[model samples]
Target: MSASAGVVVLGNTYDFFSRTRPRTVRRLAGRGQAKRARETAEKLLRDIIHAYDSVPSLTFRLLVVEDVATGGGGWTFTAENEYKVSCTLYAAAYYSTQVCVDDVLDQILNVGDRPGSLVPFNHTTTSLRGVVEAGQWVAAGQTLSWDTSQRGVEEPRPCIKRLSDPPIYRCVHEPEGVTVAAIRQETGTVLQITLNPLEYCRIGKGGAVFTK
Candidate 1:
């Protein structure tokens, strides 16, 4: 099948098995196995589309690699009879007029666009989480300065004293549904991230911080 903008394309299961599986296995499996696999893949795609629909800012398209010569990185089959579909999720933020400061700070700190003075030691200290938690902002070209005298460190440190620790958004597979597959926001990297929609009918949940 072909994919368009905001469209979900379900690949043919028989084609998938015929190309990927050994000739002996295909001969033994017959048409019934292929039909069952196709149904499972389609159901998984439907669940994925439903979950993503809740997030109005995000749009996605399934990547169906029909040709083995083209490569096969996005597809996955699990023992639990699940088909983990690989897809590209696009954000609407690119067309928005307003800037997302949180995203900007995330890029600066975690994505390698940090300032020269920003030390590599736990860059989370200079992250937006610290700024928002402390109800303060560091001005342009200036980093947070901390007194390390009592702590016995030689250099000045940036810290949010009262805040316990920063929360990390690690890429992990859920028991059932969608999860971030990878993030590629380094110095000159292009694609920001990839998401794998696991083959299960479950709704994805997440939280966002908003400011007026």
Candidate 2:
């Protein structure tokens, strides 16, 4: 990743719970339910932002926040060109009944740094940490190495690769996909799998159309 690499971040929240209750139960329900719910939602937003900052790949950018009020439902997240990822929190609480529940949905845009390259499916099982590094290829379905338990017991595991699903961003001229193919030794780079000439042309042109 380049030092100047950047990724967009977004966040939003909504609440649907009410505070009105029967006169007899008003004492139990009307005190702090809404306040708690809102606080929880806001805290979740902050946590999402902090998480984005923790990742080394992204230099955080705080774009403008746009909100809309819905009729009993939460708002939808709209992705703009600048927004590469979004985290939304939806909270509902019954103030009159002291019922509170909140859910968080994180939609990561641009997928990740090495989106087009194949990666080890079960990295936790790979024991060659720091030794193997990325961009090296073991035979398909072959055991690259073993992972050890806390007690230092080794368990064998195989190296696997897969094509990453595209994310909500402009598709650049990245390698088409990755496989269990050979990695270039001099550069420690994984070889991208071959594709149809037409598709290859598309990627090579950097999103431009080629004349017939």
Candidate 3:
């Protein structure tokens, strides 16, 4: 499946210019104007969120400040403070539609059949039911799931990973379905769930259901 990425920017454009440009009397006068533009952008972001939040499935993350840069272009007299205010607050929204498409691609690639079903594993009351270690051999079930309720993938404690912790699958019960999906959590918990047929389903725990 095709992967997607997003970026969000938030800050004062005028302030940025004022701080970076060759300071002088004329640039000082434009400070107030730059502030207003920054405020306007902030308000616009809020309004956009308000408008879309009414929709049932709409969700977003403000990943501002991940990377900041400054640049300017215009007629000669453009001072740093006078440079056009360009502070931007960015956010990304992924809908159910895109998720469905990803599922299709995973199926075609036979990702489910990969080693270790790659489900969620962790130690949280809400996630793993307070157990330090939990395992199951269900023909299906989610070993783990993530709490992406927070914004940005830049957190030190990421919800997803290429590595596994407490690394072992101790099955308490047979997998419920033919396919399974493992989701990692921010709190170090792994959520493993069995997937429906036609999805990226894993059958490593051994059962001759059908061909991949």
Candidate 4:
């Protein structure tokens, strides 16, 4: 196997810019599970966006992960969103829409090509949670808006239909009437659920059922 192919954490998850603990993410990235890193990063970003009002500091660091590939290295700072840079031959700069991201960790931060176009550094003023880790429990403090931001893809969504039983999930928008969806967990540890932003979802004790 290629031992050189691995993801390394370069920064901390709590401090906005602290170095990461080596094994904090080795469980996923080291095992060739890059998707986990991406998901975790996205969740963190969403959490920030959803709960930024109660959040405290913006000075938290990301789990700066460096994924080494055959061509070069892909550097990712896993936060609320996966922010990273790619290189085909060596260190280059390319990012994705992923939740939210910054630059190449070390780069020239500037605004438009003019002093008048210069945009001031933006940071949300509202404040609780800082950097949310994957699998961490986030309080459902606010009512989920039935807008585009609340929707999920055509995939199963986590829900809490029955607290006494294991977690139940469902999906919507296929062809016709309501149908059964898949469940991701064998236990009821999930406290949050996914909502399809495009359609209307009816959530009850039975589970989350949706429609177009």
Using TM-score as the measure, name the better of candidate 3 and candidate 4: 3
| lDDT digits (tens) for residues 1-212 of candidate 1 | 34552242333443354232333223322234333443464454344323322322323322221101111212334321222111111111011112243443343355233354322313555555544233223433222221122221021111223432211111212222322122111111111111232221211112111111
Off by over 4 Å in 3: 1-30, 59-212
Clashing pairs in 1: none
RMSD of each: 22.0, 25.5, 23.7, 22.5
Q: Give candidate 4's whole-model lDDT.
A: 0.23
Query: What is the TM-score of each predicted model, taking all chains together?
Result: 0.24, 0.21, 0.26, 0.16
lDDT assessment of candidate 1: 0.26
Cα lDDT tens digits, model 4, 152-202, are: 212222222342120111221222222122211222111222222221112
- Assess each prediction's global lDDT (C-alpha) against the native: 0.26, 0.22, 0.26, 0.23
Q: Which numbered prediction scores highest in TM-score against the true structure?
A: 3
RMSD of 3: 23.7
TM-score of 2: 0.21
- Poorest 10 consecutive residues of model 3 by lDDT? 165-174
Give lDDT: candidate 4, residue 133: 24
Point out the worst 10-residue segment of candidate 2 by lDDT: 96-105
| Candidate 1 TM-score to native | 0.24
